[model samples]
Target: MPPSLVTIGHATFQSQTLGDLQSGSLNIFLPGLNLGLHAAPTKQWVIVLAGSIKVYLQNNQSEANTAFVSSGTSGILLVVDTKDVSPVGHITETIEQTALLFMPTANGTVPEHRVLHNHVCAGEDLL
Candidate 1:
């Protein structure tokens, strides 16, 4: 499952345990900051607070390959395209001033999660 719905302390909530979080950072990306065909330095989760970004797969250049990650947890990203691990990566461009939280996992490991639909989870899926 993507996010499990569970009850804890008489309260039900949607949650998913990723893994041990290393030292993280709240980053502020200014406008026009574009990393052309860049891979992630490490495996980390990114939660957007404000603004938006566009990510396109390295080999593909098409609308369907473009991912518009906007200001929300709904589009949470787990970037793991390291230079040595991955031959190619994605192209990232900032849409505006963006505030993001980068939480890198321990040992550069990525958490396991089931893809719901188009890599998106709906409210009904929780039930």
Candidate 2:
């Protein structure tokens, strides 16, 4: 199945200070031999912090296609859909052992730390 394109944009929020917004979490996936196939666990943002990754996606009627994302030196962000209409997706391979940051949406209840500048931060960091 071919992949469908969704509108995305990179917006900057001008805040005096980073305040408590919503419940969110961070996760880092280390460079593995292979990431394999799977769908997003939740509606979240996948940030490529380092290396490169190719996302494979397809709908019920289209052929799967590839989307390449890399951090270069800084990073790249991808907003993924975990809703019912989300296309079936997975990571076919990592060109450079990718590092991913997953931040769930505010509407989700992922039992994550939601406080800003708190003693405990919720998320996973893998090397």
Candidate 3:
């Protein structure tokens, strides 16, 4: 059987202080799927909410990727350096919308941090 899924919204914060905070929903394809995190010659951070997702670091043989994260869950802070030019794998929700946060490490940096939060939405709080 397929794995179950859930959804949740997160707290609010100033975009200027937190790099670039933008809220949005995502549709994920299930069954051994991959959410590609392309290399951009900079550092990045990502979080997962709603459904279960598996993170895989490319080019690194020493350490393995992260495990599956369930609903109302949060992922570890990912630090992708510029030297590594591989896609980070992640499995997202298939039916529900996942609120994500993507931000650049520094000014004019290519690779940026992508964060996902797990919190239910109220209707009026979708900014």
Candidate 4:
């Protein structure tokens, strides 16, 4: 499906449905905190609200393989890697005081999206 523009009032906006969310939580982490290698409990949307963090997969935690995201659309990440289907998890390290928004979906369902980059959204996604 292609994205279409909808005019709500005087401005136009792109509208799309991700998925049915179960619940949401706010997670705050201190600087220099390494969450270590882990996988998401379920499928969810992770949004960096503040500061920055480096995320790497369990199989690869190198600086180059790490995925970096900040606060905004570019920071949106869909975590589908679980302990059941996949053995690989992800690692998170806080460079500063980082606030993350965790929105878990129902029954580990993932949203429909085309990844701009490897695992994270690239800047070109805004265009």
Best by lDDT: 4
Q: Tell me each candidate's TM-score.
A: 0.80, 0.50, 0.36, 0.83
Each candidate's number of clashing pairs is: 0, 5, 9, 0
Model 3 local distance difference test score: 0.39
In terms of lDDT, model 4 sits at 0.78
Off by over 4 Å in 2: 1-32, 59-64, 72-75, 108-127
Candidate 1 residue lDDT tens string, 1-127 = 3677999899998887877778799999998788788778889988788988878876466776677778755657777778877778788888999888899999887787555654323345432
| Candidate 1: residue 23 lDDT (0-100) | 71
Query: Model 4, 1-127: lDDT tens per residue?
Result: 2356889879998765658999999999999999877877888988899989988866586665677777866777778888886677888889999999999988787777665555444456542
lDDT, model 4, position 120: 42
The deviation in Å at residue 118 for candidate 3 is 26
Worst-scoring 10-residue span by lDDT in model 4: 118-127
Cα lDDT computed for each candidate against the true fold: 0.76, 0.48, 0.39, 0.78
- The ten-residue window of minimal lDDT in model 3 covers 118-127
Question: Which whole-number lDDT from 0 to 100 does residue 41 have in model 4?
Answer: 87
Instruction: Give per-residue lDDT, candidate 3, residue 40.
Output: 39
* Model 2, span 22-74: residue lDDT tens: 54555455554455555666655556777776555542212324455677422
On residues 90-118, what C-alpha lDDT tens digit does candidate 3 reach at each position?
Answer: 32322334443334455434333333432
Ranking by lDDT: 4, 1, 2, 3
